[model samples]
Target chain A: MMKISMPRWFYQLASPRWFYNFTSKLLPWFGIATLVFLCVGLVWGLVFAPADYQQGNSFRIIYIHVPSSILAQSCYMLMAVAGAIGLIWKMKMAHIIAQACAPIGASIAVMSLATGAIWGKPTWGAWWVWDARLTAMLVLLFLYIGVIALHAAFENKAGADKASAILSLVGLVNIPIIKYSVEWWNTLHQSATFTVTEKPAMPPEMWIPLLIMVLGFYCFFAVILMGRARVELLEREKRSDWVKQLILVNWTQ
Target chain B: MSFFLAALKRELLLVFRHRSDIINPLAFFLMVAVLFPLGVSPDPSFLSEVASGVIWVAALLACLLSVDGIFRSDYQDGSLEQMLISAEPLWMLVTAKVITHWLVSGFFLALISPLVAMMFFLPEPAYPALIISLLLGTPTLSLMGAIGSALTVGLRKGGVLISLLVLPLYIPVLIFGAGTVQAGAMGLPIQGYLALLAAILVFSLMLAPIAIVAALKISIRS
Candidate 1:
């Protein structure tokens, strides 16, 4: 029988301790990047970007709304992928990442909903509508809440991880169907409401800040995820020597 | 094949022995449909306008109500552990359970939906579409709901949690199911909606058992 050897980094990455150390080094960079990009993007988008011809400055909400929505969706994909990795490889660290992702993703989904509603009141003359995108986001919120609740219901940690993994994977399958159906329903209803993505093309000034905001949101997600994952790792590993020593060191410092 | 047949028979026997387990969801379906007319309007025109949606929503809830028990008793009685440890493929056993569940819950819901539809004053032309859509749509509901039931079978308060996990997944089915009857009511061809519902049914039928098996393993293991 041949023994297959994996790369050293693969094993190291699987270790929660190694992940904690590696992310600690990377966290400062992500935090700085997130701050810089968000500050620049907000200033450029709010004060400098060209206004919409039809909606005027009300469209500025897109800077926060679109990026958070994108983050909300991507965060779910990331969480599910982490869950799959955990299930297939039996990696505790991966499960930790998946667990940490649920609350952050849920909060981001809420932010998207809030910003969307605020934007809606000014532009669409109503605080709410069954517009396809909005309805889809609302469903996305429900999906997030479901995953979070399922995770919380279990007293056993491993069971919670596997259960939520199955759920998020199930949710992953539904997300595309939800997206397409909402779009189809929108067309059937012919609401003709203004959609952020409807414009054929935006000039550089408009899209440039939008691009910056999107990047900033991704960086922000990384910072929060790493921070939460580290906390989870510590809690799970509290009785371990490394965590104890780390705590003692911090206390001494 | 014999093992599968025996498992199916066992499930059916258990379900038939508890007659109210079979009747409760159907009664819920009828009662919910009754509520719609009183809550909305008593006018035939108004009830007809919302008839397909009212029936579909009621059916969806009833299916959800019944699915939590699909694996709960088996888990509680230790039969699930026995089945899991057996040499038989778990998915095969899960498919059998899911089939029995649909027969009792989804199929019965579809069969009685016409009576419930009458409460909402659904039009004559829409009756066939409603029945067909429920027939096609409810199996997918049972299949999807089985996964939720399997996941939460070991939990103490799994009923509400099962709804939370399953309802969002139920949206596509509801959309197509209601759309079929609505299209039929509007005198439009409903083949597209029916086809979509059947597609979903087939898709869930093929894939959902595998998820159910995995979730059952996790739930039972812990």
Candidate 2:
């Protein structure tokens, strides 16, 4: 019987020391990319993108709101997948990444909710409505907080990791259901009152900046995730020689 | 099959021995239901309109309250560790515990909800819908809450934490359970809402046991 060798990158990812060192080298590039793209995207979106004929300037909130909302949901998916990997493979680094993700995802969910509310006040004539998409976003925020709280409640790190992994997986199953049910409820009770923004098809001139913003948000998420993951790696691997030596070197320097 | 039955019988015996465990959540449910009429409006029309929502919310809280103890005693007593080491699959054992929990807490809640419903002057036609929805929805609540219980079974602060973890997942059940009764009250076709509740119940039945098993293993390992 032939034993198949795993890929070099796969082994590297499994090692916290390797991930920490690798991410340190890669972090600056992601940071620079995030900064440049965000600046360009915000400028293009705020200054150059044609205003909506109906919503006028208020529609511009979509640049921030949509990207954060998209990132929030995607971040949760990533967190659960990382958690599942950790649980299946017993990879400590995977758990660390999952832990690092919750706070960032939660903050982004908050950003999305706040921006949506701001946009809603101007467009929907209220700061909040029990709209389907908004309600799901709120639930997503609660789910993130639940993961965070469950992780904090455990005294043992490994126990915390496994418990939270199970929770996030369960939550992953509920996300789609929550999304669908909220949408169903919204339509069931939908009043004929005019919605401020109906998200019709947009020309490239308007959508291009929105695309850039979305990409920038992803890059931004990657940068912060790597930064947090690096810190987590250092904390979890603190007892190791490599981490101790690295810390000594930093202190001497 | 015998191992499953034995586990179910053991849990039933344990629950019956501590009768308060079975009765307290029911008492809590009645107290909560009673408070709505006093805290809100006494008008029958207003109470009837809010009846479904109030009952569903209280039932959800009752489920949450009872589920925290589902694995707490076994996990603390080390029997959960023994079960983990046994030859039978953890899924079967965990499912049996969840079933016992539903029988004690959710089943009684469903049986007693109609009496509480009448306090709010719920329309006569909506009574069957309320009872049927609870019957279907409460087990799903117990099953889902079991996952939360299993995860937090080893924790020092398990009670409040279980609610935080489980309540968000409980939203769809709450929506559909209340919707069934509301539809009945308004003279609309309730089959759709009841069918959705049953669909959710079926989905939870199929998937929640697997999650509960995994969660119990994690808690036990911890």
User: Per-residue lDDT for A1-253 in model 1, tens only?
Assistant: 9977878987788898999999999999999999999999999999999889998999899899889988998899999999998998899998999999999999999999899889888887888788788888889989989999999999999999999999999999888887777676664222322246676277878888888999999999999999999999999999999999999999999
DockQ, candidate 1, comes to 0.85
Fnat of each prediction? 0.75, 0.80
CA shift of A188, model 1, Å: 9.4
DockQ for every prediction shown: 0.85, 0.87
lDDT of 2: 0.89
Shift in Å, residue A248, candidate 2: 2.7
Lowest lDDT sum, 10 consecutive residues, model 1 chain A, at A187-196
- How high is the CA lDDT of each candidate model? 0.89, 0.89
Residue B66 in candidate 1 has what lDDT?
89
